[model samples]
Target: MKKPLLIDLDGVLRIGKEPSPHVEKFFDLINTLQIPSCILSNSTLSTTNDVRQFFEFNGIQTKIPILTAVEAAAMYARLRYRRVAVYCTDHVKSLFRGLLDYENPQAIIIGDYGKRWDFETLNYIFRKVREGAELIAMHKKRTWKTAEDGILLDVGPFVVAIEYATKKEATIIGKPSELYFASALSLFNLELHDPFIMIGDDLETDIEPAKKLGAETIFFNSEKGFTQEAILKANPDYVVNNLEDVIKILKEKF
Candidate 1:
């Protein structure tokens, strides 16, 4: 059997609302080769089905699996806490359907609250954490880019603020988190020692964390203007500027 593969959704498969160039070809290559793969997302704003729909709408249909931070956080929270307060968009919040408990919750699950984030909300979470509630953060991404707004702040700063106030670190359930990657491996019935490849754009969140999990990484250098020294520091197994190159590399190696 071919080695299992893990792909990042945001920068690899899709860039903002536009699909990455040649992404369809990459998926076709995987399907034709029967490579086991799963697309990983750090999006606390959307769920697996939402991602699936986006791809389908874009005409990049495939049977490959997907796991989003929202779904992972819900699963993690469900396993540990009975009552939880989820902070995320309405669609994303539906994942934690049965577990939402704003009043006297056992834990506070923070995600992409968007424009709803304010002092009152932050203070509420802080007070809850002080009251001994566990803090669960979807992904601590400091910033992200948008098709309309360019680059904007993400959920990380808020999570860190709460951590600073409460003196408690929130359990991160997204990319760069060991638990998140481990959970992805489980989808393929894989163990840590099993061979795998991780492809993504971000060095800190994607490359470094996957490396720690023993995955051969392919850095999709989507953004231009990275000095050679920075790329060398990341030390990915392979570096490519496009998804079509990923297909070629996989064909040659696997």
Candidate 2:
């Protein structure tokens, strides 16, 4: 039986645009051992195709599949809501560009806008919500690590602002929500009992949800800034201090 590894990109393999020190070695081991792997991310900033390019540029040789929240949200909206007013970064907008018409949307979708979160955007989204638009949020992360000085804010605050103004709770589409996970799993044509593992830095979004679905999990402790104590509470199957440790564990287990 082949083991399927679900890997998270940020903090696990790379941070921002740079790859972790031992990420290449880990990929090499996966290739040498012919282990099947898939990349799963909660990022709404890029399309799946763009994510593939990012992995290619970062020296991940496998053409492994990528499943992102942006794609999942767009697909969900297409089936449920005909039109969506997305409050996200320009990068995320590019992901569902042709799929949805942004000029006038029927639902309000919110996510991280980085430093672009302003009163005007908030007011606009609130107005749409007041006009009876449904709310959908990609993820509720409070903050994320950046290449610059300190930690940067996430979409949680922005979602809060809209919720306060509209008096409506937004539907969460990313991790902790099993719908998105099931969607990714469906792409593999694999069974629930299959030997699968989820490796990620964050415990709440990556490890806990995968474990709930009966999959083995690996926790990659990248840095103190982005580390969450909840991960320890989740009790993953394996805990590695860094990306190299993943290779070591895989070698021993497989």
lDDT (Cα atoms) of all candidates against the true structure: 0.89, 0.77
lDDT of model 2 at residue 190? 75
lDDT (tens digit, per residue) of candidate 1 on 215-248: 8999999763457888899899999988888989
Model 1, residue 194: distance off in Å is 2.6
lDDT of 2 by residue, 1-254 (tens): 46688898788877777777877788788888888777777877777787777768865666677888877787778788767777677777765565465567878777666787788888888887888888888887777877775677788778887899778998888765777666666667775445578998887788887888888899887674444466667889988888778888899878
lDDT of 2: 0.77
Whose lDDT is greatest here? 1
lDDT of 2 at 179: 73
**lDDT, model 1:** 0.89
Off by over 4 Å in 1: 224-228
Q: Which lDDT value does model 2 have at 120? A: 85
Output the lDDT of residue 139, model 1.
91
Clash number by candidate, in order: 0, 0
